[model samples]
Target: MSRELEALMLDHGADGVSFDTIVAAGANSAIPHHRPTDAVLATGDFVKIDSARWSRLPLGHDPHVRSRPGRRLATGDL
Candidate 1:
């Protein structure tokens, strides 16, 4: 799911992902900055998704180039 989100970002004109996508589920979600794994999501588990993308621009032209902000969503919000 994380990989798919990253692909979608690229499809929407993002130059590349700013970092590895995070898709932490269940107890793993308790950890900050957890990396995605092949573990299957289970019932009652909370899922968190974090992603960031960078857009192409000339060097020193984009102030946010080196500081792309990331957005996060959690199942708890749903």
Candidate 2:
């Protein structure tokens, strides 16, 4: 999702980028919060996304993944 985040940063006229896109899969979910690994994506679990952006102005960009109750996506077969 780095691409998406980069796009977002650019959209808000950010001057520089700080981190890579963090994407985690499968049991990595049990990691509480994790980053993307070389592992592939499968079916039967959930994907958690946590993103952040800091700026001088209130860009009104707030990530709300887990906050949206009941949103589901298959991550891997446990």
Candidate 2 lDDT by residue in tens digits, 1-78: 547766876596654444444555567766644766666666665765544443443456543212112223565455
Who wins the lDDT comparison?
1
- Per-residue C-alpha lDDT of model 1 across residues 4-48, encoded as one tens digit per residue: 988998897887888888888888887878976789877667877
Q: Which 10 consecutive positions of candidate 2 have the poorest summed lDDT? A: 63-72
How high is the lDDT of residue 63 in model 2?
Answer: 30
Clashing pairs in 2: 23-36, 43-76
Worst 10 residues of 1 by lDDT: 63-72
For each candidate, the alpha-carbon lDDT, in order, equals 0.74, 0.52
